[model samples]
Target: MSRKLLLKAVEQAYSDRRRLVAPLLGFPGINLTNSSIKVAQQNYIEHYKVLNALYNEFHPDAMFTLMDLSVEANALGCYTLFPQEESATVLHSSFDESRLEFMNSIEIEGDSRALSYCATVKKMSENFQDSMTCAYITGPYTLAGLILGANKAAEMTLTNPELLDDVCGTAYEKIKTYAEMLTSSGAKAVCVLEPSAVMLGPEQFIRFSAEYVKRITEIYSESDIAFIYHICGNSMHLLEAMCDAGVNALSLDSPETGMDIKKACKSAGDNIIVIGNINPAGKILYGTDDEVFNETEKLLNETAEFPNFVLSTGCDLPQAVPLENIRAFMDAGRKYKLP
Candidate 1:
């Protein structure tokens, strides 16, 4: 499927008040078990089947490839711990240098896990040709923190700025190449997650985070593949800066940041697709079905004026979140009455 079709569909939805409903669900636990994370993630067919079932059930306007942020980090020499029925996490860097000297040598295409990810994306692109199939990757700052140790990465941002810059810059190249691979395979859009950027105050965010994000977004600035920039935690303060980073959209977490999506819509303007800030764990996982429905309805009502609004979870839905809650969230969107 061509990238233009998905954009056209989203654009038509935008003008007609048919909000695009896409939860940040890559691998729901309902179809997975407490087995090795690699086993679950590498099984692309299983991943697609799970997503297809959910899409069939909910009929989302968008779907995505695996949501594991650790795939690239692990491929780039970060020692990762893949738990049974849990997302993969970085245990430590396989390399000792804070500069990430190993990045130039890391070949994501040759890496087995990366290959599986691309294959999954290709298949999804073929299967969900008419809908938006997005590819997910870790952002430079977050990947740098994983490699240099979060605390060490933070310290270096102040004490040794050059080292952190070099490391992040190198990580960005690897990320860009990997994203290109996914796009070539079948991803119609890309969502780059930069959770570590939240720890940086404004200055550090501009220096260490925003610039790299801009560079990555620029890679697709001319292409048909859309780019959505996401920073976990309360990035309320950085919303404008994120907008300046030149992504097609900005996704924020409302509960974590205490940010109003209306403000983000204003900051990002009508051209940017603003997605999410729903409290995935707090509301979607623990809250009752009524609570989830109310939250979703409230979000829709609050941002209904924005044509580019997309209803989604603030972050990835946890494996434990009940399918009933998921349904309620979608139902709320479906049943919402435009004011």
Candidate 2:
């Protein structure tokens, strides 16, 4: 854990003025193993095959588990749909407060699929010893959204704010338990995915998301685990608020969403590593190899002044993203040097 870590590796790379390249190579890398999304995510053996295959193909600096947002909700007894080729998702519905009480009684670690996620990381640590072993966990506010339904959750924020807080506090407890399990399974870092938080304004975002995230960060600070706060889409307006969460890193979306990558790097300062700006579904998927290479090199150069930075995608890449494009993107990272 001490040596196969994130902060030290990023700091060393920063001092050397080198970039750590770690795309959110989740479902797209499944092509490397010839496995379906459902099978690979539920079975640790299949999951390892995909991740190990990704490492063999790209040899990126860090290895991330599949970017599935539904695992925590499914573990809580929510009605989740598992398509053979896509990530599982919780169905939208109204829920009762008593349901949260019922879900609280259900053990999160007891869920077989949730346990498989830990096993997937366990397998990663055993094989990808030299690379950073990163895992993704549900953010408490986002999990509360799953429990209360997205629309209801947002409405509750304005109407019955207390009710939303109650649900969020309970959800935080569940996410914390699952996070501890991932840590025990040997995860060096965990990214708190809070895609739903995009619906909240700065103040509400802090109250619902960042505050709980800060506590989670404190819990793992003793173990030296790097906690990254990742909210999908254009979180440009919420960047400073996200920084206040006290995590080690912040992964942002592409500039297509009007996000200013340079300003994000400057705002995070030295405490957190700024990762990403490349659109997962952008040039890397539809453009030529040269285009992919140019875009990556440009992004690397734009944020080059910040030592605490990593080259990554704004979100998880699609499973069909051309392999040659990923190769081209990695090529840019490998070839670039700070000017």
Measured by lDDT, the strongest candidate is 2
lDDT value, candidate 1, whole model: 0.78
lDDT of 1 by residue, 234-261 (tens): 8888887788887788878866557678
How many residue pairs clash in all the candidates, one count each?
Answer: 2, 0
For each candidate, the alpha-carbon lDDT, in order, equals 0.78, 0.87
| Candidate 2 residue pairs in clash (backbone atoms < 3 Å) | none
Cα error of candidate 2 at position 119, Å: 0.6
Q: Which stretches of candidate 2 lie over 4 Å from their true place?
A: 1-4
What is candidate 2's TM-score against the reference? 0.97
Q: What is the lDDT of residue 301 in candidate 2?
A: 84
Question: Which 10-residue span in candidate 1 carries the lowest summed lDDT?
Answer: 29-38
Per-residue CA lDDT of candidate 2, range 1-339, in tens? 332257788888877767889998978777887899989888899998998988989999998999988988888887899899999889987688788788778888788988999999898988896788899999988998888888888998899999888889888888898899898998888999999998789999999999999889877666778888898878988988888887889999889987788889888897778899799889998999999999999999888888878999998899989999999999999888776
